[model samples]
Target: MNDALEIDDLTLWLGMLEKVVDGSTNMVVVTDRERRIKWVNATYSRVTGWSLPECIGKRPRELLHGPQTSAEELSRLASLIRQGQSVSNFELVNHKKSGEPYHVALNIEPIRDAHGEVCAYLSIQSDITERRQQERHTVELKQRLEVAQRLARLGRIDTEVETGRPRWSSEVFRILGMVPDEAPREFEGLLAFTVPEDVSDLRRSLADGVEAGEELDVEFRVIGRHGQQRWVRCRGVPACEDGRYTLPRSWSVQDITFYKMRLEEKRQRNEELNQLVLARTRKLEESNRALEEFSCALSHDLRSPLRHVAGFAHLIKENLAKGSVDDCLGFCDRIVQAAGRMQNLIEGLLSFSRMGREGLNVERVDLDAMLREVVVGLHDDAGLRNIQWRIAPDLPAIQGDAVLLREVWINLLDNALKYTGHRDISEVEIGWHPHPDGPVFFVRDNGIGFDPEHAQKLFGMFQRLHSEPQFKGDGIGLALVRRIVESHGGRIWATSKLNQGATFYFLLPNIADSAMPSDWGAVESVHAIGCRCGDSQAVEPGLQS
Candidate 1:
């Protein structure tokens, strides 16, 4: 009777355990030490679509995995289980009875007998496909967000409030031309990268925000590794804890280099254009006033002399026909000569005025040939008086108006010859040299030079350095040369020492050629001049005699 009661109580306990295992949602299976299935719950059959009869005498591998399962994983699992160890929450893929793949989170535990010998293995598996998919989606979204930030020229930085530790994103390191490992570790170290002019302001702003727990929006400049400065705008939000800021605060910095550059360029261009327009308006008003004065001078001063010459010449012809004396003949000759001088002066003035108003027809001209012709013409002139001329060989061709440029050469060569008429052997040298930026052409003369202080007025309209008796010129030649050279985008200046010599130099910019580093410095100097061609102050006065 005692043996029967023991067997019956054991049956009742086994039945209750089986009922609990079958009703659970997790699939449970028991395997022998050799990994052969010994017992399986009803939930296992429902989940795997395999009945007890089919799985009873089979190993777990045969019932769960086919050729697609990893042999290495199977070897590892067996090795662990034989050592009396268990693995929990391990992931695996297995095929159901219908050949459909399912992902599971598996937990395997060792079952031991009373003699402390491992007899079976208990495994519980739960479906985890949806959970794994959600995790993957979260990771993909984070990667996309980082990409968007990089495209926007933005970066994020985090700092520990208490320890002053700093961390920068990959984009931040890229913007600063630094690697993450090479970046600064502390907030002060990072702030050192900011330009010295901006560092104090940045520190003040950041401190204010941290102390008061307020949000910050600040713009500052930083010198990058390439020595190029860039502008950045940073916005930060502080995380507070009990009136004190702790860790986990972040700020976003965006590169505003392009925006700042555009604004500065626009402002500069507007100012330049405004100045140009104002200067042009002033020039037009002066020209109009000069024209009015010339009209009045022409009608009164010039016409009176012409009328006297014409009236006297007719009287001389009539007196000759009526046997007039020698006195009448001498008076006629004086009137005619005075009128001729007036005519010459009027014509010269008209030509000078027309030079600035006319447009040039630009073309490539052989400067050597042009200078040869000018020298030949000066040699033939009656007033050229023992002049010695030197012209360079193989001078390069220049893009200019032939007619206008010829006029320039004529005026310069004529001045050299006429001014040095009193000298024993008047020397004039005309040549060109190639500069790193462009070409520099010069005309030097050993003549009666003027004071260096008056060099600024040499190229002004109607400016005369010499007295009328000493150098008899209309004083419009140099001004005309200036207008012509400047109209072709060139510059002109004179260097002289009194009683020694004078050298007039001019530069043509590289309009269709590559600019060198030397060009930058020269261009800076060129822009410093307020006037484009002739002296701004000299345009108002009438031409000196």
Candidate 2:
């Protein structure tokens, strides 16, 4: 009877243990030495969708692992188990009987007998799929936050009131050029990165703020390890401690180098603008002065020619009453000449004004062809026949407006023809010499040249050196030529001596045709006085290509 009572108690205890295992939500599985599932709780069946009857003789890997399981992980697990070791919280890829994959935190313990010999293995598995997914989501959020902070050139600074210690983010290390693991973690540590002069103010600011519970806000400069300077702003966040100075507080740090640089640029630009305004003001003042001079020239020069025409007309009418037919015709010719002189000055004014408004089209101009065209146009002039032309071969091309350049050639060449009109054997040379900035093309003539002393006043409009009778011009042609050369981004100047023929040299910008570097410099304005073709001594037209 005692044995039966004992047996009934044993049955009751075993039944209670089974109920405890089955009631829990955790999955429990027992495997024999070969890792074959010997027993499994109801929870395991629910989680894995496999009944104990089906998995009883199967290994956990055979029931849960498939192709998606990492082979290396499986091999590691197998090696550990074969060594009679316990695998605690070993992460593994598992599949349910429904063929859906899930991650599980599996803890497997080796059951030992009294001799400590491994006999069986018990495993506890928790559904950690949600936990792992949460971890991945957290990582993504952290990455995005870091990216945002970096783009703003922002970092954080934390200080502990109790320890009087400081902490810097990785970005601060970049600003100060310090290694994070070895970075100073105290107030003194900041002195290494900050300028020595600023350390005291920074320390005072922090001390006062901490003591008074006021948020710290300041800008400071950091001298990196490489001695590069960077500017940063620090704005403190409240510690929010309850009268506890031991709490930690933080300040936001951002690199304001770019902002400072922009401010500096703005100041410089303002300075430049102020100077430009002053220059323009001076130029306007000069223009007013020039306008007054123009008025004087107009009144005197125009009135002189008009008076001559009038006087000649009055004299011709008086002489006609007392003279023969030939004498009357001669007086009539004088009147006509005066009218023609006035007409030339008027035409010069028109040409000068027109060139000011002419549009410029820059291109590679075949100067040889342009000069040839000038020659063709002037060929019809009766005086060009006496002047012999010596044009250099293989003339280099230049960059300038086609129409403007052609006009330049016409004026220069026509001037050459007129100045040499008195020569029985006149020679004109057109050639080029290479210069650092560009090529200088010249038109030289053996003709009556003026005094070099008066060369300075040559290019002004209506400034004539010789009388109209000596050379038939209104002193407008050289001025026009200078204007054209200046328009083409070029320089023009004449070299002459009394009686020696003049050589007018000019340069045009190079847009094409050679490997020479085009160094653009400012072109100075030049002028020619009166262009009269007469004689002195002839210089060898030793022209260079």
Candidate 3:
């Protein structure tokens, strides 16, 4: 029974020893006193591509050492082994059976006999090729990041809140114009470099961010250690663990002086442009006012002389009709016609000039009612030409100056009647329709229409489409219509086909309100006084007496 128990214990001890050697991931080799390989574990054979049978009779130098192995490391390892001591943590290059070089971390220990003499050596090795390559890659990445941060003028900072301590990267020190050794170690020390006016605000913002467990973003000015001032934008976020903020906050700061300078330049340029526009607008308004006054005075003064010439010529014709004076009568007739044509031209010019200068009193006016009144007045006039007129039903009301809009309708209808002269059953149509944005009023006529190519010129002062003999006109009617419509924030245009017909369209805004009454009575009184002198056949009685 005692023998069996001893055998069982021995088996267990052997199994544990086997496991200790075989289970190790590191390559292991055992050698005798002459440095001849005695045993090699599985890992050693796997790593070096040499079986135990191939390596058992060879020395350690023969199995692993080559020209690549450093002579200094070998000498140090030999010295330690000779003194019956163990050597550890030595790095060296070794060769495989395939002639490939490999780096390893080697630990060799000398085995001692009972007499205190070294009898064998045990070696443990770990392949470090991949680990060394990873280290190189990490170094390269750090170098690239540093270069990028320098070009971007950016800096990084890390601060521990519990200790109020701070650490800056190399770029941060460079940005602050301080050496790494000279950098501030405490938060207060870093805050001292900030501009006096911005320091308190930055502190408040940082405190709020930390309290709320939020990210921080702020812009402030700082004075570098060299006394140089710069604008910087800072952004940072906290890292937390286990419901408490454990990691120091990390932040990036960037210089923004160039961007701020560009914004200021743009603002200055805009201010200059606005000033130039204001000056030009003022000058243009002054010139327009002066031109309006000159046109009014010219029209007012020319009326008196024109009336005198027409009256005197008529008297001469009446007196000469009693005698055989054919030549004198013909001369008087030419004089009367020329004076009448000049007076018409002057009136047309005055109306065109006054259209743009007049103030607008905009209100809702029923276009249907206004057109009805205009058509009735035209039909009642003496010596009116025969024409067919049609007005559409349910014309919508528009907001506009009533007096100015009335003139627009009158001028359009009169032109239609005059241009269709002597035609059998001359037709005129006045109507309104709903447009996309507002109401459009139109006057259509079956007249001697002009070409569409010349439509743009139709609304110019004195822009007669036909000769004086073909169609007599001062050519100011459409021009006055265009000005009046535009002054009420509207638009005017015309469409026509030669010899077929012409249609004039104008748009006005629709508003729901009552029409504002104008001082039409005063205007009529003024017109009556002017017309009385215009129709008189004799000179003023006071001048004659």
Candidate 4:
């Protein structure tokens, strides 16, 4: 009878609380210290499809959360309530009794007893399923807009109508040759980069557009980063408040440099075709001058090697006449070495001639394994044993001739080793620099480097920066490297400080030989290596047969 009376009293109190919580939209829950649900507002039954008696003894998570609910948020909620504190704006994913997922923001507080001890926890849950979905949709649209602008080669800028101070998109900054997120400077400061002839007209058009609330469009030239000339087109559309108070005007800028360049090239080509007959005489004269330079360089370089063979041959004859067998053998060795030097030079010349006349035998080349083989061959040399070698992994594969590309690595690595022979602990690194143009391969070595002033001469035939005895070469190796790289539509250069390390860089397109360099198949290619006649030099010491 007493249990029956207690049940009657509890039912009466629940009815009163339901009337108090009438029209409240939040799903309110009350759980004891053991997390058994003691009471739930009518909103919880309406939202979850569970009646008061059905959820009277269940934990909230078991009824409303599943695999997708955030474990972190649940842990945080438990910690806050156990510490007799309140947690607001905590987000969690929950499910209805139908197993449909929804998002909720929880505001929870711990209910205290008379002695300040925790008794039950009260949680107010606000459903935010639609709001979270809207936020995700907004992000997706923003991303699509950015991609579209980039693909159109267009960028936007907004400028205050009176001051002309600008706010730019990332692409706008790129179009203007400024770094993204860079600090802003005065708008007039940019005029210094604009071509003087076009600046006044461009400014006048923009100012006129702002004053009259008219559309503006113009094209102008400006000096870009690194002093490169670029042409850009700007179109402006203005916005106003109350049809009179002008605000920031939106400007669309496009990089039209390539289009202008194409027009100029088409015109020049037309003129070239019409004047072919007149250009022939000038071409022949230029050809004649180039041939003389090539002949001079070959004659000068060959003379020294040939003279060594002749002079040593005569010395051998003298030693025989004196009946000195030991001296004669030594002179014979020197004669053979000089002959071998001459043979290598002739071979290089023949190879270059063939490279010019023949089309590339292009094929896929696996660079990483091939370089491993190249490094192994270099390690076979006793002189390079003490050097530290670093080869970057996962070098990209390129399509080119196996023979020519192999030669590229051989010449570069050989030069690195030769130049670094002086250091007690030599170091050489082979890596690549990737950019929008293509991959740039570099061979860096800690060596006795050359003076920067003579860098331009390093790739010329028989050009030696050091003395004859200090470093030995006909100076043909790097010239050979330059020849092969240019043939593959690539460029080669070097940088160094004296006595410090040097890095030699060569950039090759992804598919080499796809677009050959100018004068690619020229018959008289020897002129590419022609330079002032200098003393005859041999290959690196110990390179003789």
Candidate 5:
């Protein structure tokens, strides 16, 4: 009877132990020494979807392991079990009956016999799939934030108002050329890296902004630890908590060196363009002044010829009424001469007008060859006259419109030949002097030149110092030469004294040195020394090319 009573108590204790293990949330399993499942609780069947009858005599790994399970972990668990060792919280992946993967924290203990030899093993597994997923999401967010900061060259600085302590992101340390350990604790310490010239103003601006609890925006320069200068733009706004200010501010800084450099370059280009426009406006005004002078001269010249024709025609009519043939013939001759002069004036004006409209066909011109060709063409004009041509042997080739430059040489040489008609021998020298902008070429003649005081009028249309009867010309040749020279971004001027020779100088900008002279259009005074072309005494050394 005592044995039966003891057996009943043992049975009750065993049933209570089973209820306690089965009621727990964790899945519980018991395996024999060979790692085959010998028993499983109701919770195991509920969680793993396998009844004890199916799991009996089967390994837990065979029932629960799937592709998500770590092979190395499974091997480690097997080795530990074979050594009769206990392992706690061995996290690993397990699959449900539905083939969905889940994570579990597993605890395993060896059940030893009275001799301390392992005979069975007990394992308890807790589902931890949701916690692991949350950890993975946190790590992904951190990685994305780091990538964004690097790409934008962005950094942050935050200050706690009460402590006045600063916190800097890793990127901020990199931007300041400082190591993570060297991060500044005080907000004022950041000013140590600022450039000296900007530090004072930057500090004041930032302090004022913080004091007012307002947004801050400023650009300044900083000197890095490596001594490199960099431009940075910093922006921030005050932070508030519980509707009251807590964090004074946080700043977002970005490197803007390249952007500032581009703005500076654009500003310089705009200034240069403005200067160019001003120069062009000045040139236009000068051209307008010249045209005004031409207009006044044109009116006087045309009206004089018309008046002469009218007066002489009226005389011829009166003489014809009297039947006086001799007097009428004289009047008719005068009218014809006046009409011819008017026609020449109109043609010259038309030719000058066309010069401004023509576009330049620029090319390399061999000036020496061109000068020789010009002399050959003018040979007939110098017939029976003693003329000496001294051209410089080293006249350099230049870039210009060949046809227009040829005209320049023609007009200059023709004037030289015409003015020196009274001289027994005409001496003309063609040479160039070196100039910074280009070569200054001159045509010096031993002909009768105008007074030095009237030199400015030499290039004005129809403004002649000498009478038309003495040196026959329309007085438009020099003016035409000036137009062509200026069109090529060059300058021209003349110098002379009464009864002495004249020198006409022009400068054509070299292609290699195409920049025009700053003092362009300024007249230069060149003194003259004379010698006859055919005289035994050689031409004046100074006058020779």
Candidate 6:
């Protein structure tokens, strides 16, 4: 009776095992020692589209393996099974009865009898095709994100405040001029890379943002490991959990050195443009003042010469009417003298007007040669006076209009000769010195000079520091000299004190440095050096006499 009960109990146990296998979500297969399919649960048939009867005599590999399956994996699985070894989670591509491929993660165990020999093999598998696809998609997305960051010159950082641990992405390491393994553990350590001038501000921004749990935005400079200075814009926000600040704070950083350089260039250009406008405005104001002065000169100065002629002619008429023959001849001589004076005045005005309207014919002009020519022309005017011309041997050749430049030398030298009329021995020195921006030329004279206060007014049209009786001039020579100098992109100024010698200075750029503008109407292209007259401090020692 005990033997009969054991048989019934075994049958009940077998039935229970079969029911459990069929009810399972995982596909299960039981194979004999020969690797042939002995039995398969309902899930196996439902998953592979093959019934138990059709799969009973066939091997699992023969029914499920497809062209997409890995041959090496199948070989390894077979070798392990022959050794009676169990394999877990062996993944491979498997095909269904309908010829569709799917991914499978398989687990197999060796079933042994009481003799300790393998009798059959049990296999369990789970369909994981969707899970594998999801994992692959996640990896592809991460790769794309990294590529995007690199292209944008952008980097990312994550820091846990509580642990003081920081995580840097590969791009962040590159931006900081370091390798990934060299990333700082604490965020504060990153401050070492910041430039000294910007470090304090960056530190304050970080501290305030972290303390208040607010968004952080700042632009600062960083000196990388390679010692390259670059600008970077950083933005970050603290992570929140349950309405409270969490540990990790995230940030995005981007290199902005190129943008900053472009902005600086733009700002410089704007400043230059503004200066040009102001210079043009000043030139206009000067021109207007000159115009008003010219009108006054015409009405007052020219009219005086005309009135003198009319009065002299009337006196001569009265002398003739009174039959005073000798007195009439004297009146006639005075009228002739007045007419000559008026002619000189008209000629001076014509020359001054021409200086403004004429365009410059710029070329290399030898001042040494030009000076000798001017001195030779003044021989008759110098007469028997003991005059000495101390011309510097090393006078530079400059780029300017030859005709206008010669006029400059003539006017200056003539004035020197005229002012030194009272001197027993007249000395005129013309010399030049090298300057960093250009060459400076000066004419020093031992002549009776005017007050230093009137130096600036000496350049105005028809502005004469001396009266006609004091100096025989039409008050236009110096003004013409100034116009010619300015048109050639040079500057002229004089310094003097009463009864002392006067010195006139002018600067002309070298040929290589000359950047004469095509339009000289506004005269705005000239470089402005300090034009303060009588300011000994403004004059360089080399420029001093």
**Quick one: best TM-score, which candidate?**
6
Model 1 quality (TM-score): 0.56
- Residue-level lDDT of model 1, residues 1-545, one tens digit each, is 22323433433544565777888888888676777776678888998999877887698778788656677877787777778988788777777898777778879988666556675677888877678778889889978878988888788787656666677777776677776673435434445679898888788888887777777788888887777778878887777888787333577878888889999999999999999999899879868865764675576556766777888887788888899777696877879776776876687678767765778787777777888987887788746377777665556677778898888888887877776777899888776555644566667777887787998788765578998657876556787788778778777777667776666777665533422223454433332331222223311122111
Q: Per-residue CA lDDT of candidate 6, range 353-419, in tens?
A: 7765678898888777888889888866788999987765635577889998898999998988889
Candidate 3's residue-wise lDDT over 284-371, tens digit each?
7854754764564466435654766777676676767777576666667767776787778778767776664567887767777988
User: Backbone collision count in every prediction?
Assistant: 0, 6, 0, 0, 0, 0
Better of 3 and 4 by TM-score: 3
Comparing 5 and 6 on TM-score, the stronger one? 6
Q: Could you give candidate 4's per-residue lDDT for residues 1-545 as a string of tens digits?
A: 22322333444644665677646898888777677888888888888888889999999877988878888978987787767788888999998989988899988876555456665676788888899999989889878877787777677776546766666667666766778774554334445678878878887876777788776677888887777788877776657777663423566767788899999999899889769856777656644643553575588867778999999888888888998888887888888888888887777666655654577788888887899899888878745369788776566678777888898899888888888888887788776644445666777788887787888888776677888688666676777688778768788877777887677778777644432224433312321211111102111122222
**Better candidate number, 2 or 6, judged by TM-score:** 6
**Order of the predicted models by TM-score, top scorer first:** 6, 5, 1, 2, 3, 4
Question: Candidate 3: where is the Cα deviation over 4 Å?
Answer: 1-19, 32-36, 57-85, 93-103, 112-119, 159-165, 182-187, 208-213, 237-248, 276-545
What are the runs in model 6 whose C-alpha is more than 4 Å off? Answer: 1-18, 159-166, 182-184, 239-248, 268-364, 380-401, 417-452, 468-472, 486-491, 495-503, 507-545
The Cα local distance difference test for each model comes to 0.72, 0.72, 0.72, 0.72, 0.77, 0.77
- Model 1: residues >4 Å from true position, as ranges? 1-14, 42-46, 51-54, 66-68, 159-167, 175-189, 208-214, 221-232, 241-248, 254-482, 485-545
TM-score of each: 0.56, 0.54, 0.46, 0.44, 0.69, 0.73
- Look at candidate 4 and give me any clashing residue pairs: none
The worst-scoring run of ten residues by lDDT in candidate 1 lies at 536-545
Instruction: Count clashing pairs, candidate 1.
Output: 0
Q: Give the TM-score of candidate 5.
A: 0.69
Candidate 4: regions farther than 4 A off = 1-15, 158-166, 177-179, 182-197, 222-229, 241-248, 266-545
Candidate 5 segments whose C-alpha is farther than 4 A from its true place: 1-58, 111-122, 155-253, 257-347, 372-379, 382-394, 417-429, 445-454, 461-471, 498-501, 511-545
RMSD of each: 10.9, 11.1, 22.6, 26.0, 7.8, 8.7
Q: Model 5 residue 382 lDDT?
A: 78
Instruction: Output the lDDT of residue 325, model 6.
Output: 78
Q: What is the overall TM-score of model 6 with all chains considered together? A: 0.73
